[model samples]
Target: MIRVTAALSRARAGLMLALQAGLAAGLAWFVAHDLFGRPMPFFAPIAAVIALGSSVGQRLRRTTELVIGVAAGIGLGDGIILLIGAGPVQIGVIVLLAVLLATAAGGGAALIVQSASSAVLVATLTSTTGQPWTRFLDAIVGGGIALVVMTVLLPLNPLTVVRRAADPALRAFTGGLHDAARGLADADAGEVRAAVERLRAAEGTFAAFSAAIDAARENVAFAPARWRARGALAQYVDGAAQLTYALRNVRVLLRRAETALNDREPIPGVLPVSVRHLGDAVELLRQEWDRGVEPLAARERALRAVAESGRAYREGVGYSGGVVVAQTRTAVADLLRATGVEYAEATRRVRQAIGWTARPHKARRRSGRPGSMPS
Candidate 1:
């Protein structure tokens, strides 16, 4: 059932992209063939398709690269054919020159590949008598049409794209946090280990989130229709790095938890409860963000988690258990920061929750050792 749902979701996204690509290709062909009067303008549609790449974030860059690559390849091929004549040997030489030149120009993989492929096509397909810039102009028209199709005609909803990408990653992280909490409650090392593995496996989901943010930001920046989403996207941009930190901190918390269980450390009841509270906080934050509301409840939950972790520590814990408590406090701090709290304020809140109050004289002391200063 899950596989079927995933396939359907993928197909829907694919259909949308295909529609855009098809529209861009058709428009490019019409412009090149009718306006430019270039009979059989095959390169036009080809360039359009290449520019409208599958990766949402790369369309603009790919379009620019495609135009430049086409120009370079066509010019090099034409110049080489005029000197050496078109043949098997000429094709190889043209490809080599195109690849080398693109590489020297610090072009990406797409640019280099496009350059070589265009050179090969020009060398084998077109006559030397054709104008050198004819296909280059066709490439420009195709790429231009693709950009217009992507940014102006069929711009994706920035908020929708971001939500789709973020939900899966956030859900996976929340699930992992819950699993770790369960492991702590039950004193099951195996469960904690499994949760660790689950989080590690979610790297791809996090990568997708990053890419989605990039695409959404680009849409907000360029697509006038998507400009309204900029305010919503600001939360995502502000929280992205902090969210990553929070996930990492949770992973560390789980590992410490597993270690504490394996070593037969006495687990405090508040430990598992605190972790569960943090998981709840994360879910609440997501829900509130979707509803376009302040994450006040989520922040309160996270602060409570930190306070409970401190109480757990004050109740007396073994070395590994102490580390677990410490990690819980830090993780909640990261969550607080993810809610757009400034770093210093978040740190102060976490410290206050953890029952740490720095004395002014302690700050003046030159102490480099860990925990050397009074709090």
Candidate 2:
């Protein structure tokens, strides 16, 4: 059943691709015939490739930028052509001017190269008789049509895109959190290193999604939904940070505990409890933040387990182990305090970031407007 479903999904995607291609071809043909009087040789194909290669969000941005670039290019190109007359020298001057203008406009180096190439193409192709302005307009119209078709017919929904991205990001963070917790319990250096690497990979994924969110926000069609998704992602990031800190401190405590256990010294009773509590806190934060499911009961249970474990460890320590026990106890106490503070802050920040009303002041500052405040 799963195989069949996957096959059907692939078929549907293929059909959509075909439909978009056909529509773009048709529109391109119509525009070329109507505007140029003679059909364009390969312009439509080029435009279609650009449209298909770009995401809906990026296509919109690039189109806006291209339009502005073309408009400036045409005005500058025409002025140079008129002043210098149609000669090899005039075309060379137009190319130089186009490159300079594109560079000055902060269009990036590649764009300046493209702009210069486009200017040379226009000058060469229309040197004999055709109007440079008209040709420029035709190219712009083709690109614009391609943009519209891509935006309207086969629109990539930002909400769907972000939601898809969020799943992998959440999984990565959750897996790293669990691995880090287990690594602390075992005092395994290799596992700890692996967990840190996984967290870093997850961080990279979050950064990419954040960039996508920013791009989507600039899109008039997807802005509101993208903003909402961005808010949700910010919550997940905060939760991940909390989980990370808790795991780090727990890992340190476990290392200390291992040293005491190996030295045949009395284990500090509070040490085990602190490690367990920190691990529980991380797990609870992951569940609550990622799934939006309240796990307060689970958290309470974990806290109790930690407390009991700490009591047991303390009771086992004898006078012979007094020095190690005291040292470990002090370290555990400090870690517990730090973890508790971090967990609380993470919870508060996650709430605000996710649009929950639990932290109004922070939410207000994040609202992107001046002091209107978030209810």
- Per-model clash counts, in order, read 0, 2
Whole-model lDDT per candidate: 0.81, 0.50
For candidate 1, write residues 96-191 as lDDT tens digits: 999999999998888898889888988898888766677777877887888888888987777878888888888888888899899889999999
Q: Which ranges of candidate 2 are over 4 A from the true structure?
A: 1-25, 35-38, 41-45, 55-63, 66-99, 108-129, 150-154, 218-375
TM-score of predicted structure 1: 0.86
The positional error of residue 203 in candidate 2, measured at the CA in angstroms, is 2.7
Worst 10 residues of 1 by lDDT: 366-375
lDDT of 1: 0.81
Give per-residue lDDT, candidate 2, residue 152.
59
lDDT of 2 by residue, 214-260 (tens): 44444425334234455445443333333334334433444444444
TM-score of each: 0.86, 0.53
